[model samples]
Target: MALWSGRFEQGVSEGAQRFGASLPVDRAMYAQDIAGSIAHARMLGRQGILDAADVERIEKGLLNIKRQMDEGTFVWDLNDEDIHMAVESQLIRDVGAAGARLHTGRSRNDQVATDTRLYAKELLLSLVDGNDALRKVILTSARTNFGVIMPGYTHLQHAQPVLFSHHLLAYFWMLTRDHVRLVAAWRSADANPLGSAALAGTTYPLDRAYTTELLGFSHPIPNSMDAVSDRDYLLDLLYACSVSMMHLSRLCEEIITWSTTEFGFITLSDAYSTGSSIMPQKKNPDFAELTRGKTGRVYGDLMGLLTTLKSLPLAYDKDLQECKEGAIDAAGTLQDAMACVGGMVATWQVNADAMRAQASRGFTAATDVADYLARRGLPFRDAHEVVGELVLYCERRRKGLEDLTLKELRSFSPLFDDDVLEGLDPEGIARARTTYGGTGHEAVKTQLREAARQLGRDRRQASSLRGRMPNVTGD
Candidate 1:
């Protein structure tokens, strides 16, 4: 039966009931719901709103229900409507009158808000952990392939030579920002929303602070109306997820391109690759393509929630019932994508020789050649013109700039010398950039050191935040 059956004159059709139910989406939060109930019951007893005997029965009954859920033995029914009702109705059946009294000082509005916040807080920490794992994989890849040089591109055309480590660290920094967003989202969900009752403070002298302490919220949400109405934490989480997915998509796009026969800079592991049905020679980077594809779906999850929330009035609305599924879907999607991408990165074979072979193609060393002449007292614009002519001279003969003899090089510009020829080597060209955060070998080592320190700090902070979860040791 529905929780409000006492007030309804007649029941709705089964189709309408099923359509109205949030149980399917919210069942993912059963553990949080039971924990919230236990804390609420304890708070009621402490505030003298419920006697000791009833609180005991309520706590034990909720724990029993939680066990059933944990053991995957909890029976579900469509009439339960939502997780709050599902647990409450079952608790009532398990412990009779005491279970009925458990909701005496609360409403599903505040209860759901509280449960969702708790769930969000915990989920953010897990995301932080997952993000950290990927960042570590990136750092490891950078370290393992430290001196491997590759062509860095702008506009998808070869622009310069850069270390493979430098390319990988670009992604590491992107995920570092993603970790920040996830933690910020966690803090957004840290405030407790219990004891707000429906849309107003209840007559019962409920000790909200005690419940906050029990649930490990940083503080109680100050206003009753906003407490039950707000779904901003989910927005924070969804935004974080969307941004992280975008970052993953960018990396995966590179992975997909690099794994191609044309690039051949890296090879996806057989575990992460798949073969075409018709062509035995095909080993497609399907997982990378999948991650890239899933990025759009996660973006849709964020937009779906934003659109659902755009025109709602103050306090709780049925529109808020449209909230949970998107956040849940986004989180699960992000977690799975992270796992797949992390594994793909960890096991993939880096084609260092192939990467190095193509690192200096398409006159990639042209900029350094220009720099070389500019350093030799020629006007930089003149040096640029000189190099442009030199490039044409080399192209006409079907030879590389390095392939030009000294006499041939000097014929284009007096600044052309042996050192300019020496600088044409791809590794020297990449290593010449010694500026901080540049693609230089020593600069990359500096970046890797700082990345290690940042990873340590983030790991510690995530661990501390996780420690604040209620029943961290498990109830």
Candidate 2:
């Protein structure tokens, strides 16, 4: 029988029962559900809503259920509909009338909301660790290949020479912003919804603050109506995952391009690469390609939930049941993508000579030429024109800026001197950008140190959040 079936004359059809069940999606949150119940039961006892003996019985029964779940001995019944009912029904069976007292002042509306929030908090902490791991891998790569020069592009055309470390650090900063988003999501999920039973204030003298402390929530949600219905925290989480996945996709796109024969800038480790069955010579960056492809699915997860929540009336509804799976799916997708990207980055071999060779080929020194002329008394526009004509001349002659003689360069501008040749050197061009946050080697060294500091701070913050969480075994 369904938990709410006593008031109805007939049982729900098997089809409807299966259709309405959230068991498949929410079973992963059973630990959180149990934790929330234990906290609520203790709060009830403290407020004298339930006696201490009943609270004790409820606590022991909940722990036994958690143990059965951990040991794979808890059998789920589709009739239970959701994780809350499954756990509650088992609690009732184990502790008799004491379990019946557990729901005296609460409703499934607030209970589900509380459980989801707890689960989201736990997942966000894991995500923080995952982001830290990926950031460390990026910092390690930047440090290992600090002075390697690569062509920096705008619209896929080489625009300047930049240190490879500088390029990788750009993603480090992107993910640092992502870490902020994750923390924001965590804060949004930190409020306790347990006392706002069924979208309204409960009749019982519930000690919401007690439950908040017991469950490690920062505070109780101030608005009872909003507590059971609000899913902005879930949206915050999905948005964070979407943005992080997008960043990963961008990096993966570059990895795919760099590993190709035409670019030849990198070679993914054999462990991260796949071989062609028919073409013995082909080594494929399939993992990078897959991560890039998975970005669309993460985007879909966000959109699906947004559409579900768009027009729903306030308070709990059947429609809200659609929210959990998307958030869970997106979280899982990002976690796997982060791990894959970190592994790929950690193991890839940088082809320094090939990178430098390509960096030199595409007139990457044109900007430096323009800068050279600009520094030597010509207006910046005039300097740009001179470099444009020089690039055209080199293109027509099948040559590079470095291939030009001093006399040949002087043909374009009297400003040309033997020193212009030094400016044309790709490494010299890269190291010349000494402005803060520039691609210069010294600037990248500073960036690497700051990145290390930021990563350390984020790891410490995540550790602190983990410490605050109520220690549930096997969570």
Candidate 3:
């Protein structure tokens, strides 16, 4: 029988029971639900709302149920509707009236809010760890491939020569922002909502701060109605996931482009690539392609939750049941995607020769040449125009600037000399950029050090959070 069936004239229709059931979706949160119940039971005993004996029995029953669940021995009933009632019904059966007393001062509304918050906290920590792992891989790649020159693009055209490490560090910083967003989402989910029974403050003398401490929440939620109704934290988490996935998609897109025959800048490991079913010569970057494609699905998860929460009125409503699936999907998707991307990056082979060859083409040194002329007393705009004419001349001759003789370069401007040839060397051009955050060797080394420091700080932050979380299972 359903837990709320006592007030009904008849059992709900089989179809309604199936339609309203959240067991399948929320069963994943069973551990969190059980942990919340244990904390609430202990709090009730301390406040004298339930006697010590009943509290002891309730606690024992819940622990036993959790053990059953952990060991895959618990039976699930479809009529239970959701994980909360499923556990509660079993608790009552095991411990009789004491288990019934567990619900005296709380409602399913606040119970669910608490459970979801705890679950979100756990998932966010996992995300933080996953992001940290990805960052470490990026740092490793940057350190290993430092000073390897590649053509940096703007609008998908070669615009300058940059170290490959500088390019990888750019994504490292993107993920650094993503880590910030994940931490923000964690903060949003850290408040306790357990004392806000139904849509209003509870009548009992409930000690909310006690439960907050027991559950490792930073503080009790300030508003009752908002406590049960608010899903902004979930939205925050989904947004973080969506944005991180989008970043990964951009990285994967580059991986795809760089692995192609035309670019030939990298080769994905065989474990991360696949052969065509019929084409003997095909080796495809299927993992990177799939990661790129999954970006849209994560975006859909964010939009789906936003649309679900768009028009709902305050306080708990059945509409809120639509929230969990999207969040669960997004969290799992992001973790998997990050793991895939990190592995791909860690295992891929960098084609330094091909990168340097490509970096040398496309007049990548035009800016350096122009700077050379400007440094030699030519006005900057005039130097630019001269380089433009020189590039045009080279294009017409089907030759690169390196192929031009000092005499040919001097024809454009008397500023051209033998030293101008130094600016045409791809490696030299890359190293000439010494501005802070530039792609020069020294600038990239600075970035690598800063990235290492940031990664260590984030890992420490994650460790601190993990330390503060309550032990759900008594080992």
Model 2: colliding residue pairs? none
TM-score of each: 0.98, 0.98, 0.98
| TM-score of structure candidate 1 | 0.98
* Tens-digit per-residue lDDT, 353-372, candidate 1: 89888986888999888888
Residue 259: error of model 3 in Å?
A: 1.0
lDDT values, one for every candidate: 0.91, 0.92, 0.92
Pairs with backbone N, CA or C atoms under 3 Å apart (clashes), candidate 3: none
Sort all candidates by TM-score, best to worst: 3, 2, 1
Best by lDDT: 3
How many clashing pairs does model 3 include?
0
Q: Which ranges in model 2 have alpha carbons more than 4 Å from their true place?
A: 472-475
Instruction: Put down candidate 3 lDDT per residue, 101-123, tens digits, no spaces.
Output: 89988999999999999999999
**What TM-score number comes out for model 3?**
0.98
Q: Which lDDT value does model 3 have at 293?
A: 91
Q: What C-alpha lDDT, on a 0 to 100 scale, does residue 305 get in candidate 2?
A: 90
Model 1 residue 28 CA deviation in Å: 0.8
* Number of backbone collisions per candidate: 0, 0, 0
What lDDT is reached at residue 399 by model 3? 98
